[model samples]
Each structure stands twice: as structure tokens, then as C-alpha cells.
Target chain A: MNKMTRQFEGYSFIGLWIIGFMAFSLGPLLFSLIISFFKWSLLDKPVFIGLKNYIDMFKLDPLFWKSLKVTFTYAVVSVPLGLIVSLLLAILLNLKLKGMGIFRTLFYLPSVITGVAAAVLWMWVLQPDFGILNYFLSFLGIQGPDWLGDPNWALTSLIMMSVWGSGGGIVIFLAGLQNIPQLLYDVSSIDGATKFRQFRAITIPMITPSIFFNLIMGVIGAFRTFTQGYVMTNGGPLNSTYFYALYIYNKAFQDLQMGYAAALSWILFIIIAVLTLLVFKTSSSWVYYETERKG
Target chain B: MNIFGKSVTYAFLIISSFVFIIPFIWMVSTSLKEPGAIFAFPPQWIPDPFLFQNYKSAWTIAPFQQFLENTVTIVVLTTIGTVISSSIVAFGFARLVFRGRNVWFAILLASMMIPYEVTIIPLYVEFKLLGWIDTLRCLIVPSFFGAAFNIFLLRQYFLTIPYDLDEAAIIDGCSTFQVYWRIMLPIVAPALVTVAIFQVMNAWTDFMGPLIFLNDQRNYTLTLGLNLFRNSYLTEWNNLMAIASLVTVVPLIIFFIGQKYLIGGIAASGIKG
Candidate 1:
């Protein structure tokens, strides 16, 4: 047999065995779609409402809009800033300087920490009264805001808490940096390309794929962010930090609106799908393809 | 290289390092502090008198013994489930030729795009109907099936494994499953460790899953229990810091020690974002 046919023959078992995985992974997801279409109350039989849940959320619900606004604001402000920050750190970290490994590990340490720990720790730091943050500020003769308790600062505080342990992005960026061949740097240097130019031309283009990956994943990940919001703020300070996921969580578990929650899930699904498509659409301009496209 | 560039790198590195280390250093320091100085600033780097009593305080506040037990048990189960199921499914996707393979694989790939949070509501209702709330089953069941990400990882790694290895195993009269157990699994040790560590770390630090499913309090995992201690009050700073420190630091210490393994495994696995 030819290489293609042999490879095909080799992969033939996946056809049969994937059934078990498909059943479990896809079963609940399919069930979710059915639940999304109905007014499922668990206690009673679900009533089919078609797309009423979507309609209600778009035109009727008050909290949904607020949650959407808060979540979108977070995604926009944080993603690009985080990308730039982490990429800069990745470049510095990629340096051949001594003790850089220690620095790398120290930076990466934050990501391994549970979100709960960081959230709790920040609650103390952001505390306006008797907090170490405020105490330090008093030395400078300035007062600190009640970060978690203030409506305006609440979401921003949550964002700060989110970025506190953002080392995973750095790890990916570092790995991407490693993939850029040394020759690129060598040739650019021979041409007397300045350090800034080398970085702009060499570092940026080569890491475009990872940057695209991180951006898409970052947005998707941001939308699903719940731990800090659930732990630190509990969607409080007049619901300024009330994220979409948190709102869905409250609707399902707290208020027993399973149908509404499922509906919310589908809504989130649509949003993410559209967003993913948008990223891919825009990626043609920025994302570097390594291989020639058959098309 | 410009002197300015070098100094700027150092400047950024130093300040960023401080930002990273403060919470960790404070966590350890406060754990060793007396109750009176828990929040005192310049946040006394050295507690006036080192207290071993904080450990005792942290232990007594919750059924942490049960929390530890539950956390360990669930993590072990999930790790085993993820390893076995993911590898099995990955092999099928990786090695076998089956009908509608592209369609099924595409379905699995599509599942990766749908965020895990999207399924929580249906899962909750499904589990509630099955009366699995507060049970460890709720925690492990979802992961027991091959996750799309893991399956994708294993498939990618398996693709890299030479076809010659499987052919040689088959020539020795090995069944497909035996070839998998004897040849495939062994060769994929690095990938397995990578996945195992990922599972362990995720299970160790996961607060949201246990917080939602585990309602009995006795069934609380380390992360949830630590959250409870911290969230209890503004004044219970000593107990809060001590307990939170204990739980958060445990897995981190383990990861720190195995940092080489984690860094190596992550690089080797080449996991998709």
C-alpha cells in the first residue's frame, strides 16, 4: 500500500473506539442544546419556548446587559495589555543573562497558584481600611479606595487580581520565542539592525502564530472567567463585577433557573463562535502561516 | 547591546519580580506570625515571635483531614480516568482507520472550541437528576471521558510516534490493545507525565468545581476549605492567612520541586493553546 493508504489503515481503529468518548463528551453537550430550547425547572417537565430565552436576554433582562457590558469591558481592556506585557516579559526572559531561569520560575509561580488564594490575598491588599496597601499609602499621605466594596473600582480590582497570576501566557510566549531560529537574529545583527528593530522585525513576526493563539484563547478564557469573580467579589459592590458566567451560575444553582442558565450557555456559545470566526477572519492579516496553503 | 536596553531589562525584571513574590512571601510570613501582627505593616517581614500554633489553628477550623482525603481521592481518580480514557481515545484517533473518522474527530475538535463552562448548566441538571451533587462522582465523571484537549494532545504525540513501532509490535502477534499497552503507552511516558501533572495541578488548585458540586462541607477540597477560612471574616486574618497559606503552598511546593519535570513535560507535549 502507498504511504497515504497505509497511514489511513493505521488510523482505522479510531473509527470504532471514539464512540465511547463521543458518548460522554458530547452527550451532556447535546442535552444542553435541548435544555437551552426549553424552560427546564428540573422539578417540573420542561416546556419548549423555542428562542424565548434568547429574546428575553436581548430585549427584556436587565442584569444580562449589565453582565455583558462588564464582561466585554474586561475582555477588551485586559487582553491586549496582557499580551503586550507578557510578550515584553517573554523577551526579557528569553535573554541569556544569568539567574534568568530563577526569574522565569518566579514569574511562572503565580500561575500555578489557585485563583482562590490570590483573590483572598488581594482582598486584604485592596482593603481601604486597615489594609497594608492603605497603610503604605498613609506613609505617602494618600488614602486608598475601598477596592472590593466600591462600585467603580470593583471590576477593575477583579481585573488586577486576574492579572496577578498571569504567568501561563508568559510561558507560551517564552516557548514561542524559543522556536524562532537563532539565524534570524544573527542575520539581522550582521546587517546592523538595532536591538529594537530586530525585536520588531524578527521577534514579532515569528511569534505571530502564538500571539494569535494567545489572543483567541485569551478572549475565550476571559469570557469564562469565574473563580475570582465568584471568590473575591461574589459579583457584588452593586454587581459591578457581575460577569456573564457568574450570572449564569446564579441563575442555575442559586435561583434554580436551569432553563435560563442553559439558555445563557447557548448565548455564550453563539458569542464565542462569532468571536472565534472574527479572530480567524482578522488573523489573515496578522497570523503567519508556516506552510504553503493548498488552496 | 545598548547599556540603556540592559538597564531597562533589569529595571523591569526587578519590579515585576517583586510584584510576583510579595503575595507568596507574605503568605509564608503571615503563616508564621502571631495573630496580633497578621495585618500589621510594613507587614513585619519577621513575626515578633514565630508561632507554630497557626498550623494547629488551620487544621482545627475545618475537617481539613476529610478535605485532604477527598481532594486526594478525586484527583487520583480524575488523573487515572484522564490518562486511560484520553490515551485510549487518542490511540483510536491516532492509529485506527474507522468509518466517519473525520466527522467524529471534527466533532471532538469542535468540542474544544465550546468552552467547558457552557456545559455546566446541563451537567448540573443532569447530575442533579442523577442525585450526584456533593459526590466525588460529579467531580470525576466529566473528565473520565477523554476531554477534547487531552485527546488532541495524545493524538498529536501519537502521530509523532513512528509507524514502525506499532508494526513491529503487530508482527510479534500483539493485539492492537496490547500494542497500545506495551509499545504505545511506554513510548508516550513523557506525554503521560505531562498530562498527569496537568491533571494533578488542575485538580489541586481547582476551586470552582468543588465549590459548586461539593455542598456537604465535609466533602470540601483544600481550595474550597481555604476559601471558606479566608471568606469567614475580616478579623480572622491569622487563621485565614495560616490556612490559606497551608493549602495554596502545598501543591505549589510540590510543583516547585518538580519544576524541572513540569517545564520539560510542557515543552515536550507541545500542547495546543
Candidate 2:
């Protein structure tokens, strides 16, 4: 092929993506930033009111702070808790035995029933009066709290629900676990290390990359939490579950404060970006890559 | 491992798996119970007289048929667009030598990190300007543009193919497009299937996209339809479970059929990251 044809062929392959990136991804991103400066409800022409929306978010909107508190609290609690649960699940399921696949599948089944369906099912599961969780708790002579109804327990309930849906994390960790060389365990065993010692020395360090991956993703996912609060609590029990994303949704769709919502979303974007960068910065200390040789 | 250790491991696994799957069993049990029987003390594990009528009522009482049609339209079209467009773009990044190829690929990777919530409001406004609000096109059109994740996935798969294969194909007078369409696509079939399956699940379970763009009852996706049902029929536990099960089962069925590809995709995403 001539140079012209070769270049054309190459560009043709990527042309669709360039168009898509410009139109859908880049364009909307920049436009949302622009809209953050203007006071535009759907009906009105955008009026430039540059810093008011951002300033008001910080000073005037108490719900903005409230939503941030709720979301950060959820992320702080849920992310580590979810990491521990999923890692443990991965360890147990890593046993090289017959019928392990069935157990893995059963464990993963709940995550597939995600989004609205999962949210609705948990609403019943966390129902105050006749929920299966409370009913099951009764057998142990413990009274379960009114989970989604009480202000204190509502966020906790959502966190627990998130743990149950940590099947995706489990699968990821399992893959990471399997990647660990059996030779490491063999060497540790030969050195007369205890099982716990072997795990701490060999297992944990090896899976730190997966841990790091899940932690970053988990933080981002937790910050974007909306459907659970929207569907189950309606951000209620005195705005206890008023997540940041839910606040954004209500601002844009319910209150029709498009400009304010745009600003809220930018704040959220900055929070996530900063948090992700912080994690990436910290990853060098803990995350172990197999390719990196010890100096 | 010793017998005691083996037995303990088995016991722990069985117990945890039961705990994991119990809610699903509860959902099914609730869906089949008589409406009054749902709150039965000690919670009837199984319905004595199974109420199959709940499913019928959930389906009949709403415009579920229309909802299903709307969902199918969006899922099918988006899946096709995602598979074809993503792979073609991926082939370019993997094989075709071009100026700024690495830069473009880097830009694409960076774009993936931008959260969907950031651009959603502006996109909604853009769709409204195009008069696509309350329409399925708003949901479907975006997929025809290659998704970053899907393109990245297929690009990985394409790069794994030996370059000699492409060289031979080119020497045989196959054009770049022909090489991608014929040789490269088939070799990367697994990745294509993986992308298609992920898109189907994403489009199927997507609540926010439809919520933002689709306002008309006639254009409601299954996620929107189920949310509406939950709101209007707050007290109908049996019917609610039935409809929830109906919505949940489609993806469950799809997962079962595409279990290998789906799990492979998850593992690839984690490990590659």
C-alpha cells in the first residue's frame, strides 16, 4: 500500500472513536463545566452567574455539606469493610477442590441482580417489621434494628447491602489470588512458617495490587452511590441517607436547578479525582507488582 | 490438608454460600406466596399454595409488554453498535500504524477515568436540544460511538494476535478493512462477545440514563418500569417481588448463558488494571 492509503486506512479505523470522543465524551464534559457557570433551568436561556453557584454550594447549601458527610461516611466504612469481606471470600473459594465452581457461582449470583432489582429486594430484606434479616435475628434472641427506617441504621443497612453485592470484588481477588505462585507457599511451608505467617508474608503482599485496585474503584463507586438512597430511603429518616449523587439528582431533575446541579457534579468530580490521585500516590508504598524486582 | 482442616473449610464455604444465596431464595419465596402470607410469622420458607397469579398480575397490571419492547430495542441495538464499533476502533489501535496513535489511545484511556455523572447533565441538555428526550434514541445512539472500556478491551485482544498473520493477509492483497473484518474480528471473537455481554447487562440494568432522558411512559425501559411499579404499588409485596424477579431474571439468564465471557471480562479488567 502507498503511504497515502496506509495513513488513510489507519485513520479510518480510529475515525469513529475520534468523532465519538469529541461529540459525546469531551464535548459534554466541557459543556457541563460551562453550564456550571450559568443559571439555566431547562426553560430559561443560560444567564452567566459565574461564582454564585459554587459559592452558594459552600456557604448556603447545608444539604451540600450534609450529602458530603453522608457519602464520605459511607465510603469510609463500606470500602474497607467490603475489601475485607471480598478478600476473605476469595481466599475461601480459592481452595482447589471439587464443586468449588458451584460455590463461586452461588456467591456471585447476587451481584448480577443489581441496580433497581437489588435495591428493591434489599428494601424488603431490610423491612422493619417482617424482614427476613430481622426474622432471622429473632432466632438468636436479638432484635434487629429498623434498618432502612431509622436514621442511624439506614446508612449501615446500605453498607451491609454493598458488602453482599461484593461478589464482583471477590471474583477479582480470586483471579489475583490464583496468580500467586504456589511456589511461594511451598517455600514458606518448607521454612516451617505457620499458615497465618505464610498468608501474611506471601498471600497479602501478593494480592496488594488487587487490594489497591478495589480500594480506588470502591472509593469512586461509593461516592457515586445514588440508586440505593433514591429507591430505598428517598434520602430520608431526616436526610440521613442523603448521598451526594442523590443530592445532584434531586437538584437537576426534581428542583430543576440545572446550574446548581452542574456545579454540585463538578465538586463531586473534583472530590473523586483528588481521592483517586491520593490513592495512586499512596499505592507505591503498599501495592506489590510481580514485575518489580526488589533492589 | 488434614481431614479436620478440610472439613472446617467445607463447613465455612457451605455456610457462607447459603448466606450469600438466601436473599435470592427469599425473593423467589416471596414472589410465590399469597399476599397475606408474605408477613406470616416465622416466615413461611415455602408457599403452601403457591401463588403463580402474582406474576400474572404484575405483568398484566402494568404496561410490562411495552416496557419489555422498549428495553429489548435499546439492548439489542446498543449491543450491536458496541460490538462492531469498539472492535473496529480497537483494530486500528492494535494493528494500523498511524501518527498520534499512541497519543489517541492515551487520551481514550484517560477518558475512561472521567465519571459518567460528570457529563450526564450536559448530555441530557444536548439530547433535549436534539428533541430526543422521552425517546429510546437517546439511550441507543450513544452506544454507536465506541465506548472507551469496550474499545480498550478489544484492543488488548487484538494486540495479542501475531503481527505475522496480518502481514500474510496484506501480502495476499487484503485491504486493512478486510483484514480487520475477516481475520482480526474472528480471532478476537471472545473479546467481542465479552463486550457485547457487558453492554447488554449495562443497558439492561441502567436506571439513571433512562431516568434522565426518557420521560414518557411509552418509552420507559424495564428499570424505569419497575421503579414506577414500586412507587405506585407500595403495599403489594407479592406482586412487587414477582415483577422484581421478572426484571432480575432476564439478566440472570443472560449471565448464565454468558457466564464464562462475563467472568473472564471481570478478571481481565482487574488483572489488567
Candidate whose TM-score is highest: 2
Model 2 residue runs over 4 Å out of place are B270-273
Candidate 1, residues B1-273: lDDT per residue as tens digits?
578977888888999988877777777777788878875756688888988798886787677888889989988999998888788878888777655677878877777777667776666766777999889998897676666777877788888888998888888899778988888999888787778888888888887778777898888888888777766654366667777777676668767777765665555545222
Per-residue alpha-carbon lDDT of candidate 2 for residues A38-125, written as tens digits (9 for 90 to 100)? 9988897999998999999999999999999999999999999999989998898898887889988998898898899999999999
lDDT for position A150 in model 2:
93
* Docking level for model 1: acceptable
Q: Quote the lDDT for A162 in model 2.
A: 92
TM-score computed on alpha carbons, candidate 2: 0.98
lDDT of residue A40 for candidate 1: 72
**DockQ for model 1?**
0.49
Q: Where does candidate 1 chain A have its weakest 10-residue lDDT segment?
A: A15-24
TM-score for chain B of each model, two decimals: 0.91, 0.96
TM-score of each: 0.92, 0.98
